[model samples]
Target: MEDRRALATLPPLRGRVQQDAPLAPFTWFRVGGPAEWLVRPADVDDLLLLLRDLPESVPLSIIGAASNLIIRDGGVRGVVVRLGGKAFGEVSVDGDGIIAGAAALDAVVAEHAAATGLAGLEFLCGIPGAIGGAVAMNAGAYGSEVKDVLDWAEVATPAGVIRMAAQDFAFAYRKAVLPARGVVTRARFHARPGDAAAISTRMAEIRAAREATQPVRARTGGSTFKNPPGAKAWALVDAAGCRGLVRGGAQVSEKHTNFLLNLGGATAADIEGLGEEMRARVLATSGVSLEWEIKRIGEVTP
Candidate 1:
């Protein structure tokens, strides 16, 4: 009775269920094993029904457009809930506010806002994750962040649907301390009126900046480590001579040491090992410990 085959015993779901689904294709790192059980709920109602009846002992995990994650080589256990479909991809303009489904891509949200002459969300165009993941982590870039624009978010929790504000989450510097077991479903962000042309121009600049600084085309786990306090993570990594450092099929990006890249055929172990080595090197040289920004999930291959 392996976990992959255990999904059949769970309470009935109103969504598609796949056992032993390969997870590598869903991640930016593109290097992981399978999910023991992957569930994509058709809509919020469907998701809520499933969550309400789900066994308390069964683990629940959610992934968005799926960046900033490392699904280990031995695959995940329990249910990996991915919010998708029309129910989770809609973007609407509510006055000066933009309401987006959690599954909507950050880039798409940016585009929707810009198209509606909203200015504050231009930074989202540069983020690779979807709104669900973005909301979960208070994802940000350049000088702007989600907390600045987020009015409230709809999440499914054990107590049923709840509206959580930025203050509720205590959002700070790429961190959002959400309620345990809550799943973000939708978000409403407040934006100011601006010239559509100006917003588009700003988005273009941000995208261009990312292209110049990051190894955008490579299979990478976005930023491997968060900036340690006042020190830039990349500078410390470079000072430690870790730029372009290689481990198995993974390498620290020459273009951006902050990012760990799969140079092709790298396993989850190789990538994680390289990141740990970076942390050690940086700590030894800078006396400052780097913290992982990427969420590493699942089991390691023995």
Candidate 2:
């Protein structure tokens, strides 16, 4: 009853809203339950309006491409916002700078930068998910991270949209401290003049490396664990004999032990449980506890 009243009081916006929307299709693993409420605002203004007016009591969650995420079986409660479409997926170049909407794919942004002869963002080509998620997590690859190129980002909070400098994010390995309930709208990245062909070649090399070593075509979340200090997560997992380890329908990718795959018909529980098993094995063997890089959310089946 309270949920109905909250829904009725939601501010009208030029966006799509749904109740009990299936969220599996939104993720790379293609496993998960529904969202209690899913909102996709048409533009930044619409987003701001929603943020400003949403009841403080209502739970709000945000998702990007869900490349490195696991949403559990019992579904997420309250509202879940996913930014997309031209309003949040545009990528453009301004001189040596690239401006990308939060929803723009990291690879797309890298391509746009390459087309504009900007070189610094080539690393983005290897990172999965959207700019928003990249910025939030300091996503990196090929010895480069978002912090290396990000100049500033615009985030919409309940108060208003605020432009924050990259340093203000206090970026650390695979993490950033964003404002409470703030949604990244877009970001500006600093780049430099470079040979487009060379940049493209480098991106291609990274792509080839990923395809050869990782499960690029599998139903997998990106890297499952953070590389512990002075140690690669994959190497540790392999050393612990966790390569291709299976639990139910989920398995550690034989190609890359750091990744977890849903081998068709896998539930979220199966995938997560497999990851836990891998962690236990690594800890018992190497005495190095692994931290998850993939974000997990929602409730488990009761």
Best candidate according to TM-score? 2
Q: How many residue pairs of model 2 clash at the backbone?
A: 0
* Each prediction's whole-model lDDT (CA): 0.89, 0.93
Per-residue alpha-carbon lDDT of model 2 for 103-139, expressed as tens digits? Answer: 9999999999988888988889899899999999999
TM-score of each: 0.96, 0.98
lDDT of 2 at 156: 97
- Residues 140-177, candidate 1: write the lDDT tens digits: 99898899999999999866889987789899888898
Candidate 1: regions farther than 4 A off: 1-9
For model 1, the local distance difference test gives 0.89
Candidate 2 residue 107 C-alpha distance from true site, Å? 0.6
